[model samples]
Target chain A: MATITTTRDGVPRAASQPTRGRPDRGFGTIGGYIGRTVLALFFAFPIIFMFASSLKPDNQIFADLSSLRAFLPVGDISMDNYKAVFDTVPAWRFLANSIGVSLLTVVLGVLVNSLAAFALSRMRWRGRGFVLAAIIATLVVPFETFALPLLWWVNKLPWLVMQNGQPMWTLGWLDSYQVQIIPFIANAFSIYLYYSYFSTIPKELDEAARIDGASWFRIYRSIIMPLAGPATATVAILTFLPAWNQFLWPLMAVQSENLRPVMVGVQYFFQLDVAWGPMMAYASLITIPVLALFLSFQRAFIGSIASSGVKG
Target chain B: MSRFMIERRGTAVLAGVATAALALSACGVASTSSGGSAGELTLWTHNAGNPAELGVINQIVADYNASQSKYTVKLQAFPQESYNDAVVAAATAKKLPCVLDADAPTVPNWAYAGYLTPLDLPQDLVSKQLKSTLGNYQGKLYSIGMYDAALGLFARKSALEAAGVRIATVDNPWTAQEFADALAKIKADGKYQYAFDLGTGDSGTEWWTYGYSPFLQSFGGDLIDRNGYKTAGGVLNGDAALKWASWFQGLVKNGYTPAKSSTDAFADFVNGKSAMVWSGIWHSGNLSKLGADGIVMPPPDFGNGPKIGGGSWQWAVSSTCGEKAAAMDYITFSLNKKYLAEMAEKQNVIPATEEAAAMVDGWQPGGAKRFFLDESAKYAMIRPPTPGYPFLTTTFAKAAQDIIAGGDPKTILDQAVSDIDADLKANNHYGF
Candidate 1:
């Protein structure tokens, strides 16, 4: 038996390694690094510009646009734009609303969509194929195609409310948090992703769980869900993004300013004289949470997309 | 547990969830008609994020609400950018507020659509306001503004002097040849990158029509034939319009102005990048900060005369308002000369009434901005009064953009006329 060797970093190394050319490997590795660095800089430019511009005065921001100084926070930097952002918009309120809506969407979307996906993927229902096909077919019809009709229908949708200790039926769902959350929970793409992931799981474990006197709910809770970490992460990221970035629906459905999300607040800066500084500040503030979420789930998000043939 | 029982329970759970969702969705359906209960009135304004304007509006609302105990006005402010979409959505659901503000140009279309009702204000007060501030549809007033907006040629006096160009005025504006020669002189001077900033980069369709269509009017062309409010046949695509188009496109071709100005064209002019800027009067305060050398002059007369687009945001009573009387009362109360002057001063806008103008400082007879008031009164033309004005403005704006981008002006203008006529015909000239 060939003995294993330990590198200087204390990682184990195989002794019977195949013969490889060192020069080619070294050049290829350097090329990979250069390519990655270039790609990273390309995607990082906009975010860097937004954050950098947020600190500079409006005139300096425009003046520096043609130079490399735009990317560097080198001159006349202040937090006045950030202060103006707070004064101009109800930033905390909008942030709180967006967080609440996005979190609720992520949680409920995962549960409902995954459950439907479980039934469609694991169960032996008679018309399961047709139902799956129908769900997938909905991906072709864009949300804008049905936006007006959806607005009309949602306006007519009934909601139970308590006013002055009496139960009352409200006709329109125009300006409320529920209007933003409930309609987006059963996302079709999320269901398909979950279904696609669930079908790849071994059936033996589910059968063993069933034979051991476990219910379908118990099996889903104990067995399949634990292994759907990547899919769940991908769906959560996808659903949370659109919900947080929602502009059109909230603009139409919600009339009260206090209930509006951060995206709608972006329009508040586009008055007769556009407030470029305050707008950049507001954009930077709203982008932080999304950036954090994306960075935290970076690995699983990429893995799920790669494995499921999904492009984000 | 058996597989059959497990499958049944899963199906049952799914059915239960579906049922619950339906039940939850079904509970919000109660009929909500237009207007509020007897004593409460809902008023909407497009003044959110515009704290100065919103403050003036709120003060008026407060004063009016306190003036009488018969009605309490509840105000909802929407940001100006999405105000129209919100209003349209509310109108679609038949949930429009009892009182709301509409952009001046949309007044005719909204009135024709029964979204607005004719005003019943006292004629004495109505006659005191500027004619351009009144949203008249079919000779009946549908809306009224507290102030009017005007446009002017913003120039640096030193630049004009250096170029030996005569300053234009309301009485004797620069003719087409004089304007072109002035531009040529300034370009020959070569001190500035461009001679004029025409605000071509402002993408708002309203800005395009409001800022440029007046030049077309000056060239003896109009967006549509106003006599019958019918078509754009000879007016928009005629020889005069072609002349205006050629001159407009020539400014870019000859490098007198940028083919596309930046969003900060006024800023560029103030920063000494350009000598002249064609923009609205709102920039007067900012320009004045640059010193007494800043001059506001009338647009050059192409052929007929100098013209500027008229009208501003105005208040209206919805047709579905349960208390139209109270809504009209609030509008009337809000238009008090004192309130109008206060709005004009605080917002730095031209007061709608001559008396209010006299009350404000810069708008007085000999004051600095009286020039704008004179220009507005003398040359302001309200956009076409037909309900199809919206379609006309949009189509004209797109065609004008195409013309500036080097498309054949005749062909583009022809297409614009065809599109406008088709839209008017589709709506049967909007009740003529």
Candidate 2:
């Protein structure tokens, strides 16, 4: 309450935050809980509808909106839809592929970007601001604007050099996991995160670590790395979820079904002449992982926002 | 100064995060190798998921490759909605395959833009087989028809039995008035709803335009002049479209049909929720899946002429390559009656030819013969092949949407004619 009125210009306003011993009011708090529950339910309705529809027999899903006998009809609630997922499409294999790409993206992308982040953030000698500004400036440009140029650049990689002056490049990245995972790892959002987090860590940590028998790289690997736990987790979840659910990028990049991800498989569920039970079943499957990820990481994700909202 | 300090801090963290992301992205990918066996030609299509269907197509592609020692084709796929856009982009970048499964309306646009090569089908061939399917802009055969998708009605046998209604055959299908009474009877019977899936789409647009528009033309309701040049002073602002709109509006208001949300006839009817549903031949797969014992007849003739919503899938080759002979060979094989049989049977699509239609044998649903042969024929219609058709659908669908959602039909139709008039002028497709 004090923070709302008195902390306009920052007079060490941490004291203005409400004390944690007890809440000052209980009625508004109950009302607030009720309001939040209602709002949460509103957001949860479509997902609930999808899950409910998944449990139904194909026909009654769309046609029998009023049949009250079953949330899941006994015979109807059988694993036919899930069986369709496994048999009709290689649902699990695609899911495994998705996991592989996501893991690689998280591990490799976080490490490289963090190293670069450390360089740009802590060990600044010259042109640091200019380089950082240029990176930030790229944020305004749309990814699609760079699609053709990036495609050409990927083709022009030295290791994947053109042979014998024939048409094909040796990389053959199309429809490969490399194509799917590599292009997305270096996102503007991740760079922005590392830069900001790097700036906040006192330059003294870098100086002290560097002065005490450690080289610049060693200082970065030890001190700068451990302090970045929350921020790294912050970037990992934000980056990975979108990469997991990504449809268009993989679509534009990967050209074969064997190479396509689970998202495309889920989308094809709707293209059929009838999209009732099967569509819902597949939709529920895709959404479940996303939902579980959010629920498990709810604390860390929320904590990052709360901390960043104040300091950022 | 504090603001400056915060900005500096924000920029550093952002850059660090971005660079870390870039590093992570450089991870290894298990590369895929095409161990080359010579003579493969690449293909791009949207039908990658259906293995059985693709297998049939691949055999045809194989046959084509076998026919010529110099060529072998490879297949690639994108999502169906993405199919045309991807093809268009490929054509621009010279990345398109020798042939593609393309939309009919686009064949003309593509052909006009150096995107497609014309087929060499003779007038006699077209006269006997495809006069109805070909677009006649410049009077040359540009593409061949693959299949015709005609609209029809689907009713549940047990559901209709409970409602105590009977439809004998195509000659005696229900008139509009009788159709209404029967639906009311079905509703009053309480075991099943009257009808579901009163689509506010092409069917509704056709209902007001051609189904009810014929009534206007018969009773002298004119939308515009023959060239479709003037419409603001036209008779469409009068009663023809209105009458059709009111009939649909009545179907809901009188409880003879389900509400917009409750109109999934295939699901509801097969599951025994409603007596009847209306859809096209494309939905035969769904009805068959529910088992033959439960499904029933197409609706007896509703009050309409020999018109229903029917359109064809056309096969044309891209002018972007010299693979026309191979492309045409692939097209002919894919559309050959034998190849289309399983697709028609398993996927619930109507065959474009008699031989393909007769080949539907696997798991025929009970009481579904009427769907394959009869009631759908009585009211089938296709969109006019005017270049302005996309604009026309948007205009008509908007009006129909407004009417179904409770807008005044006369007002909407009035605005619609004006809108369509402008579109036709813009696209230069002004035939009445």
Top-lDDT candidate index:
1
Q: Could you give the TM-score of chain B for each candidate, in order?
A: 0.94, 0.73
Lowest lDDT block of 10, candidate 2 chain B: B29-38
Rate residue A77 of model 2 by lDDT: 65
For B1-432, candidate 1 gives per-residue lDDT tens digits of 667987999999999999988766655434566766679899999988777789999999899888999999989888888898888877877778999999999999999988999999999999898999999999899999998889999999999999999999889999989999989999999999999989898988999999999999999999999889888999999999999899889989999889899877787788788899998877877788579889989998887889999998999999999999899888989999999999888888889999999988888988988998899999999988778887988998998899888899999999999999889888888998
Model 2 scores a TM of 0.75
- TM-scores for all candidates: the values are 0.93, 0.75
Which prediction has the highest TM-score against the true structure? 1
Q: Per-residue lDDT for A40-67 in model 1, tens only?
A: 9999999999999899887777677778
Q: Residue by residue across B268-294, what tens digits does model 2's lDDT show?
A: 556665566665565666677656544
TM-score of chain A of each: 0.91, 0.81
Over A1-312, each residue of candidate 2 has an lDDT whose tens digit, in order, gives: 222221221112234456448665788899989999999988977777777777776665654455444343434566577766665566777788888888788888888788878788777579988887888888799877887666556544423323354323344455568877887888667777877766666676666666676777787788777666666777778878877886766666566677777887865554435455776787788777777877876766665555455222
